[model samples]
Target: MQTLTGKTALITGAGKGLGKAVALALAAEGLHLGLIGRTQKDLEEVARQAKKANAGIEVHIKVADTGIYAQVKEAVSELVGLLGSVDVLINNAGILKVGSIVELPVEEWQQVIQVNLLGAYYVIHEVFPHMLAQKKGDVINVASTAGLKGAANMSAYGASKAALINLSESLMYEGRKSNIRVTTLNPSTVATDMTVNAKFTDGNVEKVLQPEDLAQLVVYQLKLPQRAFVKEVGLWSTNP
Candidate 1:
């Protein structure tokens, strides 16, 4: 297995859910972290947890809305400067809006797309150059299974994720020449706080996939030798 020790990782939405879990997992593996989120408090808490996970690992936090191009550009540049390098990137920042076409407001629908699709694009646009210069990097884009099919009351969220999947595919092809490994992950109904609070998942959280489970998967993928990488993966709960 490859060692992640001393490498730097930039994770979006690192304040909570799968992002938070992955941050801690990577810290445990001895990777320096650059955490990005909109909430300062949330990012601070996650950074604290990551430090506790590995006292030797460096943790940098930045608050920015990924939907805004200017903010994303500044955040990525500043974090990269602080962390020295970005060997890994987790584009896990996203928002979900559940409503029919007519029921969901136009602004809300646009917001979802802005944050999920365009936001990822903005971050990748900024980070790709650094990875290219380094000639090596790993990127994991966290999509959702809802993108694979249309469903009732999931128009906005599904559309955003679908776009993300397509974007990730294109990025994978483009980055391979530079040795930048990109993986697109589609997880179904993870038992995250957002899912539970939004009532998106059934009450049986125990039967559903957890944030830490996905975090372990990220760690495993990153541990694989540079010559090999997972192109895409669809993770689902065994019983849910």
Candidate 2:
């Protein structure tokens, strides 16, 4: 296993849910953190927890909406300034608008794409140059099982996650020579606010995958040896 001491990680949507859990887990391993989220209060809370885990570790919080390119650029710049250099980038900001293609509004679909797909792109684009210059970095993109399999009433959300998977693959190809690793994590039915109200085809909320479990998996990946890279991991609950 590799140690995370002296490393810095930037995680988007880190104010709550899986992002928050991952931040705490990384901090436990001695990684400094940059928490990016729209909610200032939530970001502060996560930062507090992360600092508690590692007293010497630095924590930088930035309130930025990942869907906006300018905001994402500014946030990345601020994070780099505060933490020196970002060693790991976690693209976890996304939204779910469950609707069939026939009934889904164009605006709603666009909003999902903007946040889920384009948002990841904006972050990666801003951070990749620095990673390339450094010749070493890690990117972990939080996708969904919808990216691998199409489900009913998930046109927008599924399409966006699928795009993220493709983007991660493309990034891996580009960064191979530079020793930068790109990983895509596809999980099903994580128990978060986003999934709490989500109804399946049978009108039941699937609560099999928890945020902490997802966080543990991400931390495990980060602990792997530098020469060993798990490019893509697909996780699903047995009950789901």
Candidate 3:
């Protein structure tokens, strides 16, 4: 197993939920962290916790909306300068707007696509050169089960995630020669703020996935050997 002791990881949506869990998990393994989120306070809290775990580890926080290309580019540039280079990139920032196709507003649809799909592209584009220069890196896209299977009232969210899955596949093709590993995780019903308000068919939340479990998987993938790559993995609660 490859150790993460000296690596630096850049994670988006690091304020809470799956992102925060994954950040802390990587920190536990002695990885430096570069956290990006829309809220400075949340990012700082995560950084504080990470620093407490490993005092020698470097932590950088950037408050930039991933939806904007210029901001994403600028943030990545600054992060590379601060952390030397990002050894791992996690695209975890996402939004959900549930509505049937006929009832979905155009703006809502666009917003979902903008944040979930275009945002991933922006980050990948900005970070690709750095990974190429280093000739090795890990890119994990936090997709959803909605990406693989359509659901009622999830047209917008599902479409965006599906695009991400395809994007990750394409990235693997382009980055394989450079020794960059691109993996996508499709988790079903993670228990987060995003899912707390979601309208479940039977209002059954107990069967949903847990952020900590997903975090464990993220850390496990990070530790995998360079010769092997799990391109895409789907996770669902057995009870769900």
Candidate 4:
């Protein structure tokens, strides 16, 4: 396994759920962190916990709404400057809205697309140059299994994630030449606040996947030697 000790990682949606778990896990592995999210307080808390995990690691936080291009651009630039360089990018920021097509408002549907799909694109667009210049990097797009097939009331969310899956694959092909590994993760029914609030998993989280479970997978994938990489992963809970 390649040690992540001195590398720096920039994670979108780092305020909670899988992002927070991954940040703390990476910090324990000695990676400097740049956490981006809309909430300043949540980001600061994550940063504080991360520093406790690795007293020597540098952890920086920025407030950015990934759905907005200007915020993403400014936040990424400032974080890249603070961390020195971005060795890994976690494009995990996303939103979910549930309603049937006829029942779903047009604006709400577009909002989901803007946040879940365009948001990831903006982050990658800004971060890819840094990775390309370095000739190596890892990019993880935290999509959802909802993209694989459609569900009754999840049209907007599914469409957004499906687009993200396609985007991640294209980037994976293009990045291979530069030694940058791009992996798309499609996880089903994680017990995050999003899922619980959406009522996707009845709050009986122990029976389904958890944020830390996905975080462990993220760590494993990133730890693989640079000579090899996993292109995509679809994770499901056996018990669920």
lDDT of 3 by residue, 4-119 (tens): 89899999999998999998888889998999999999999999998887888898999999999989999999998999988999999999998999899999999999999999
For each of the candidates, give the backbone clash count: 0, 0, 0, 0
- Tell me the TM-score of each prediction against the true structure: 0.99, 0.95, 0.96, 0.99
For model 4 the TM-score comes to 0.99
| lDDT (C-alpha) at residue 22 in model 1 | 94
What's the alpha carbon RMSD for model 2? Answer: 1.8
Instruction: Write the residue-wise lDDT of candidate 1 on 59-155 in tens digits.
Output: 9999999999999999999999999999999999999887889999999999999999999999999999999999999999999998999999999
Per-residue lDDT of model 4, residues 1-240, tens digit only: 998999999999999998999999999999999999999999999999999989999999999999999999999999999999999998999998989999999999999999999999999999999999999999999999999999999999999999999999999999999999999999998888998888878757788998888888989999999988889999999976
Worst 10 residues of 4 by lDDT: 197-206
Each model's C-alpha lDDT? 0.94, 0.90, 0.91, 0.94
Worst 10 residues of 1 by lDDT: 197-206
Off by over 4 Å in 1: none
Candidate 2, which ten residues in sequence have the lowest lDDT sum? Answer: 198-207
Candidate 2 lDDT over 16-118, as tens digits, reads: 9899999999998889899899999999999999999889899999999999999999999999988999899999999999988989999999999999999
